[model samples]
Target chain A: MSFSIDQILRGDIPRVERPPAADPSLVPVRLRVNGQDHDLQLEPRVSLLDALREFIGLTGTKKGCNQGACGACTVLVEGERVNSCLTFAIMHQGKDITTIEGLGTPDALHPLQAAFIEHDGYQCGYCTPGQICSAVAMLKEVEHGDASHVTSDLMATDVQLTDEEIRERMSGNVCRCGAYLGIVDSIRAVYEQQKGQ
Target chain B: MRAFTYTQATDASAALHAALQNPEAKYIGGGTNLVDLMREEVERPNEVIDINALPFSQIEVLPDGGVRLGALARNSHTANHPLVRQRYPVLAQAMLSAASPQLRNLATNAGNLLQRTRCYYFYDTTAPCNKRQPGSGCAAIHGVNRIHAILGTSEQCIATHPSDMAVALAALEAVVQVQGANGTRRIAMEEFHRLPGDHPEQDTTLGRDELITSIDLPALPSTANSLYFKVRERPSFAFALVSVAAVLELEGEQIKNVRLALGGVAHKPWRARTAEEALLGKPATAENFRQAAEAELQTAIAYEHNAFKIELAKRTIVRALLTLAERQLLA
Candidate 1:
């Protein structure tokens, strides 16, 4: 019952491509997911989110709005953040991708995850995965001298992970359950801990 | 979404060749807008030519003290480029104030400029929208058009181009460079966009076969201070109800050069040419800005539900100019 972007667009079941039309049909795509390489055979239209959940069995990335409006499908592609639902599996053939699955495990939680646990960042927990992934990506983006809307000094040499900075950068992710306070607090805690470390 | 053939084009010529090969082929960049249209069943392409792998992702300085931004350069990358931040701060600020980080990361420079309108009727299949289905009859003409245009509109369409980045680019005199089947051509930023006069379906001046290669921006002088002021319902991830991109250069106490652009008020990113002409060499006072804005918007016509736009647009322009001039006075 999954939707292919083409089926919805065409309003019918799209004809399967001719064997020669797609070279190396459904070939295993090699991707560096979560700092590790993965080889998965997928249909040409499979999105990165589906490829991870169906092929690799990482269901941490939730699907709230299949469109990019809700950030439930956020992921890091080559150190930059992107909406995973809009990306094709084949397009990311040899690129590095980091999903919520790669962030941390139960046995060893990442600093952000620990902060969320400490500060209670989630109420319904549906948007937590996307929020955490977006948080992780924003941290790296800020460190790299990328400026946010609230970043007044565009040429600032050093970047501080301020609360306002994190909020502005992480505005893509939503907490529908109304856990914004705790979520921002969790991210701030992580930012403080990372600075201390 | 339906199943379609996907081809990755590694260069501009290859992209054009592939596009020419199929009438149903559509170029794909970040897929932020295209995928949304697909999910809504508004756009259907038999084959999608992926342009993400193309060599169109660089933002660099051009030879003549100008800036050259590639088509595939992500919004995040373009908004934060050092040269853009320094020379065209309004463009940088406008881009930063656009959709949030994740969406911006996946939206390209060209795609942002070429984005379709967010009109409700166009998105809703049941409603009659000329932009979505030309000659279907526009329901928004007398229907709910609070977000529709007030200038450069027609009986057929009143949809507005919804790009904060383009609004600022228009004021900066940015030029769009495209490669087509015939050859490469440069379109001035002001002419790149088209108003929804008789043809509501036509979006830009670009031909169907054209692929925008890069955007060229003229050198902005240091004293020509600029700012992008956006008035939205929310502080984040919301389209502007009214936005102003103003770049003004002052000589002592009088205006030397002025460029004013308005968003969310016109069918395209409207360059306030009339207002600019009126304000040049005049004292950079609040009253002069108000007069200039009024003269520019005198021809503006509003729909039933959006008449506030005329006044709102005027206020936005005056406020943005005054703020820029005030900063100088304080300094």
Candidate 2:
């Protein structure tokens, strides 16, 4: 029973049955995160961000804005970075999900993690996990010759990772403490080290 | 977010069947925009059909030198595809100029076209929005409308479609292939998006039961000379304040053919037909570009906080054309 706009404007609120209550049934969802598989029961409404923090107890991936505006919940799904807050956990059944916790540990830090420490890439550190996760994939994107908005030549096969390129590529993650300069330095340091190796 | 049952469809037929069975079902691709909208209560579907497993993730070049972009092709994949970057650089530039890298990674070609506006009043359920709740007053028409539409606006709605990719497609004259309950149909890029007339709620002419299969781009030899220029509050990761996607072909110093489309200016991608017509055979000069831009924006009606956009649009249009003309000359 659909009512037209004219009918609604005329104060004729269409008589329709109220939508059914939220489905409380917990659906079984299997997720592989940080090289581990976990089977759990979760509602379809649970986002990957919530599933990681609440159910799996992996709080490294922060949730700044759950509406996809902030990249605080960034995670690598199948090696491609995406905002975990914007996708449902139930949808990621067979994909390999990598969060900040999966990158490296404190003793054996990832090169980018060590570089971030060496360059002082954080102040408040609230957005660090997402920043590191984003950088992990962003470096891979550069290696694969992905173009950004600042990429002058689209046909060029080689991409020069300039400071401008890094800034443009990493624009998704925002640090409220304004650690952009240090973040740039850390990413560049890692990039140069990798090139040297 | 409202609880909804989720089901994965391995095939298009199963997806359509699921959608047909539930009148309140919505197909999900990447779930970038739809998930956020659902969380905000702007969109509430009782059933969510995951079409990610469907075989629509290919980006192939046709024999006619054109391109066919699968509906489920991720924005990043499409932008980085060799054919798209080499043949249609403007499209790749447009896609890159849009949302941040993370969003482009998750967003699909078809979902990008169907994304709703970033209208404040529409997202804020406390306020009145005709598009959100039909017959309700449009707060954007009188309230802070710095990001609202300046042309093709109705008294009931002033929201602009927020899609950088669609603007480029409009200029390229892309075709959207759709499959519905009846059969298959093709919709031109210009006619796919609808203007806010009496019914502000309807965003597109697509039937509720219809699903987008792919988008086909016609071969344009002059596409290599095209450019997509976007101006926003920031250099990156922001919607366009005024954007121009232009393809300029020149015979010596005279303009042979041109296509201009503007984003963040109207309900749909505003194809500057009047501007293109004015520059068909004219000398590619700054004065002529400005005149054509003026002719195209003559009917634009700017509101309180957006009167500056009218002039901004004119300047952007001229700058884009001039840049393209200069590039052509250098080539």
**Candidate 1 regions with alpha-carbon error over 4 angstroms:** A1-30, A35-41
Misplaced by over 4 Å in model 2 are A1-23, B222-224
Q: Judge candidate 2 at residue B315 and give its lDDT.
A: 99
C-alpha RMSD of each candidate structure in angstroms: 4.8, 5.5
lDDT of 2 by residue, B179-289 (tens): 998889999999999999988899998888788999999999853479899999989899998899999899898999999999999999999999999999999999999
Model 2 compared with the native: what TM-score? 0.95
**Model 1 residue B144 lDDT?**
72
Q: Can you list the residue pairs that collide in candidate 2?
A: none
Question: lDDT by residue for model 2 over A89-172, one digit each (tens)?
Answer: 999999999999999999999998998899999999999999999999999999999899999999986889999999999999
RMSD of 2: 5.5
Number of the top lDDT candidate: 2
Whole-model Cα lDDT of every candidate shown, in order: 0.86, 0.91
